[model samples]
Target: MLSRAARPALRAGASLQTRAVLPSSANFATLREIEGRLKSIKNIEKITNTMKIVASTKLNRAQRAMQDSRVYGKTSNGVFESAETKPVEAENKKKLVVVCSSDKGLCGGIHSGLSRYIRREALENPNFDLVILGEKAKSQLQRTNAKDIVLSFAGVGKDIPTFADAQAIADQIVLLPNEYSHIEIVYNKFINATSYEPAVVEAFSEEAIAASANFSAFEVDEELLSNLREYALANSLYWALTEGHACEISARRNAMDNASKNAGEMINKYQILFNRTRQAVITGELVEIITGATASEDM
Candidate 1:
């Protein structure tokens, strides 16, 4: 121990040990961070997967309801289609736009697309009022078109819409003091599981229905025209609500599926990174031990 060469060897080993300890501690910290991230990603993956499954289960039911409502709505409006009804061209009259959306999110652009359509329409013809159903669209339109929003409804889309719900909403609309020339029901139309688009279902007012090009062909009593208008509006609203619900379910399923896949990918990458970092740290420790042993042996 007193020898000059032995002293130098000890000093060299001490230096090497110091270097190794510092780097090992830093690497351990890095490894801990990576491990924590991996755990968080794994948890995220589980949640996304569960959501995807739930959406998939609900999709079938929503689509069935949509199909049934579509038929009901079309049958109710068949008379108007046959008569070729058209809204009267009155500049003094204001039109009503009913926007169908849901309170919940995670469906890609379903609500936003409807909002954008309304905004674009506002830019072109600013003579319309909004009757928004659901919180999502209401919140969006309220920011820019607060004055235009005459009515907003909540607690919708919690489940499949019943005809009673639509009827109740129609009754409220009919009671409004501001008479509308015509009402347009805007909703996300379900094209397929992977696709949907904004579409409109027209609900003619009593005046518009009466002014049909072939109104005289039907032996309809003039007294029953108001009741027909109300019934037609309810049918159309129910159809829009069901179709929009189906689209939202499908969109949510796709979105959650994609999220789960992305989370899985991240998890895999992080796991590999963690393994590599752990191996590197262990290797560094082993190398330090070996180097110190060799230096002492030389002494």
Candidate 2:
């Protein structure tokens, strides 16, 4: 019942339809891949945005704590400055170095910078012991100077550091079996919202403070010397901890902000690619249909 010419046209149309279907299936697969990537990027953006908000919220409180602690610490150390107190270095006397860092990471190279400074100091003098406050620094130091670490504290920098926290840490240092001639606290000095530097705050021993050339200038009871030293150490620790916390929060906020921006850029790129690919697929289908229709008319 079918003419020969009609059969040929029918077969040609079926062939063209098959070819179109194959490419369309391939295009769909590619579209699916792109969609998956886009979804993943969106999720990453959400996570980074959330982290940025948290860091921003904590930054204000941390900055306030840092300011208050700075004032308190400066006031406490004024006597030492007036007397020009300096630690007496001796080969037999061991030095204690306390590193102030946080347990949480993702805040740029804050903890790493502190760790590097300690490593440099170790190279200069291996006789000093380490007391790390925070897991990040402790882990880094333990890899190389495990034996030199006398104490390590966790759960620090979760919130603004309090005077009580510093007092407890100072009490532990004072109770150590070995007597240290000098106590140095290493912390991130908050220069601005975007800049910070690792610095040291020295806490001299009772003998060192009294040995200063200008010690006679300050009239003080010998009985109060130990109490004064303990108080000064606590005040310095609190200042260091608060300042370091502020720096960490600022760094984290910046890092998360950058991450979110990158994710948004990736999403935009993928969206464009997806749209272009879909348009190309539609154009290909139209071309196939037009070709098939023209062939049928010729038949």
lDDT of 2 by residue, 1-299 (tens): 99986898777877677775667778878989998999999999999999999999999999998999998789877878889898887879999999999899998899999999999998998899999999999999899899999998999988899999999999998888888889999999999988899999999999988787787878777888888889999999999999999999999999999999999999999999999998988998887778777776766
TM-score of 1: 0.92
Model 2 stretches with alpha carbons more than 4 Å out: 1-21, 287-299
Distance from true location, Cα of 110 in model 1, Å:
1.4
